[model samples]
Target: MARAPGFWFRQPGPWSAALAPLGAIYAAGTARRLSRGGRARVGVPVICVGNLNAGGTGKTPTVIALVQRLSDRGIRAHVVSRGHGGTEKGPLRVDPLRHAAARVGDEPRLMAAFGPVWVADDRVTGARAASDTGAQAVILDDGFQDPALAHDLSIVVVDAAKGWGNGRCLPAGPLREPVATGLARADMVLSIGGGHAQRQFAARWPALPVPHLTARLQPLKTGMDWTGLRALAFAGIGHPEKFFATLAREGVEIVRAEALADHQPFSPRLLTRLEGEARMLGAQLVTTEKDAARLPDDFRGKVLTLPARLRFDDPAELDRRLDALFD
Candidate 1:
C-alpha cells in the first residue's frame, strides 16, 4: 500500500489508462458479489463502520466511539477486522499488550480496549469466534468492501477535508469501492469535521436516503506540555496533516514534522535518528497514539505521545440510532 499523501493523489497517467478497462471489470465482479444476499447469518446484528474513501477518513475512531456506545447500553459488542498490515495467518485474538502493530494491526489493537476483538483474514471466521465468545453484536471495522460476512448496517464515513480525492478509485483515486456503491449500501453517512468537509458532503450527497450525521474529532485531555515548546512531530497515519493540524490547534510549536506510511514499523536505528534530529533542533520528538503503540518499549518513554478521540457534537441522536441496532 502507498503512503498517505501521494498514495491517493499520485494517480498514474497513460499506464493506468491502459489498465482502466481491467480495473473496471474487476470492480464490477467485486461489486456484484457485494450486492448478493445469501451469506448473512444474523445471529446478532452486524454493524459495519466504514468509509467510502481509502486511507484516513477516521474509520478507527468512529468504530471506537460506536463500540463504547454499545457497551454503555449494557449490550455486549465484539469487534472483528481483517487485521490489515499484520502478519498473522488465520483467526487470532488481539491482545493489545502482547501483540505489536505487526501482529494485530494498528486499528484492531486500539479497538480491543473497548470490547472483545478478533482478527482474521476470513471475516466470517472472525465473526464465528466473536459469537462463540458471547458477543451479542459484531462491529466490523473497515470491512464494508468485503462481501462474505453480510452486514446488517453499513455506515460510510467521509472525510470533510479530503472529500473523496478526485472522486476516483484505486490507481485513479482514493476509493476502495465506488462512492455510489457505498452510498447505496449504506444506512447512514457520517461526515466528520467542520468547514470544507461538512460543506462538501452537503453539496455532493444532499439527497442520500440515509441520515447524515456530523462528527468532530477532539484530542483527549492528555496533560502533556504544549506551551511554547519547539518539537519534531511525526506520524505514519493515513492523514498526517490532521495530526499536525491538531498539534497546532493545541498550541504545540512544530519545528520539524515528518510523515511516513500508514502503520509503519520503525526500527531502533530510525528511532535513534529521530531522537538525534530532535536534539539537534532543540525540540522534543512526538507522534500520534497509533504510532506510539508501534514504538519499542525501550524508546516509548523517551518520546511524547498524543491521544485523539472522536466525539459527536449531538450525541443524543447517535444514541437513538445505536439503540435501534440492538432492537
Candidate 2:
C-alpha cells in the first residue's frame, strides 16, 4: 500500500498544517458534490457499507456479514462494487468459477462465493442490473462519497486503531471528507475492532448524533490445527498489518509478515519468491481470503487462507436497523 504520511495518525505537524489548504479544497469539493445530489434510486433497498478513510476499514467483510444476515432473514441480497483494480468498466456479474481477480477485482471475486456480485464503475447501473435480476436488497461495498446512487441506509465504518488520523481531510490527514460532514450523512457509525477509536472519537465529538455500533472480525472456524503452526503471513489488503495481527491472535507463530499494495497482483515470480522464503524459514505460506483469491491456480493449494467473519456486539440493534430498511 502507498505509505500514509507519518503525521496522519499523529497530532498535526508542520507538514499537515502546510497541506491544510489543499485539504480544505478537497473537502469543499466533496461537500459541493454532495450538495448537488441527484442519486438514482432503484426499487430495492440499498445498504451502503462505507468508510471515512480512503483505505479499507473492513467494509468488504462487513458487507459479507450484512449479506449473510439478510440471507438468514430470507432476503435475496446482492453486492455492488466499483471493481477498483479491474480492466472491465462494466455492469458485469462476477462468476468466481470463470472470473479471475484480473477481470473483476479481488474483492468481488471473493464476495461472489457468498452470493451475486456485480462490478460497475457506476454503482447505479450495477444496482439497477442486480435489482432487475432478482435482488430484494443491494449492498454497496464502498462509494459512500459517490452521489451516483441513492442509499436507504449508510453505515460508516472506522478502524478502532486508526480513527480519524489527525482529524484532517485528504492530503492533510486520512479523512475523505470532514468527519462531522460525513457523519451527518451516516445513519450508523460502525467502529470495527476494539472500542479505543470509538472512545477517542466520542471524546473528540461528544455531541455526535449517529448511533454507534461495535464489531470485531472473528476468524471462521476452519477446523484446521493452526496452533503452533509457523507461518509466513502476507496480505495485500488496505490494512495488511491487521491481517498479520489476526494471525498472531489466532495463535499462529508468524515468522514474517509482508504487506503489499492493496489489490496488488501477485505475479508468478513474486509467488515463487514468497514460497521459497517460507520454505527457507521453515514456515508455511498463509494469506487473507482476498489475497488468496488473487493467487494463481497452481499456487493456491500451496498457501493456506485465514477466513474471518464479522461478529456484531449487538445483533439485535443491527437487526432493528436492517429491519427499518425493508419496513
How high is each candidate's TM-score? Answer: 0.91, 0.96
Off by over 4 Å in 2: 195-206
Candidate closest to the true structure, highest lDDT = 2
Error of 1 at 5 (Å): 6.4
Model 1, position 88: C-alpha lDDT score:
78
lDDT of 1 by residue, 200-233 (tens): 7678656777777888788888676687778799
Clashes of each: 1, 1
C-alpha lDDT score of every prediction, in listed order: 0.79, 0.89
lDDT of 2 by residue, 1-327 (tens): 476777998999998999999999999999888787678999999999999887878899899999899999899999999887787787999998988889889999999999999999889999999999999999999989998899999999988777778989989999889998999899988888755655776676566578888888889997987889999998998889889988888889999999898988898889989999999999999999999999888889999999999899887778998898877
Error of 2 at 160 (Å): 0.9
Model 1: residues with Cα > 4 Å off, grouped in runs: 4-23, 35-37
Query: How many Å off is the CA of 83 in candidate 2?
Result: 1.2
- Candidate 1: worst-modelled 10 consecutive residues by lDDT: 4-13
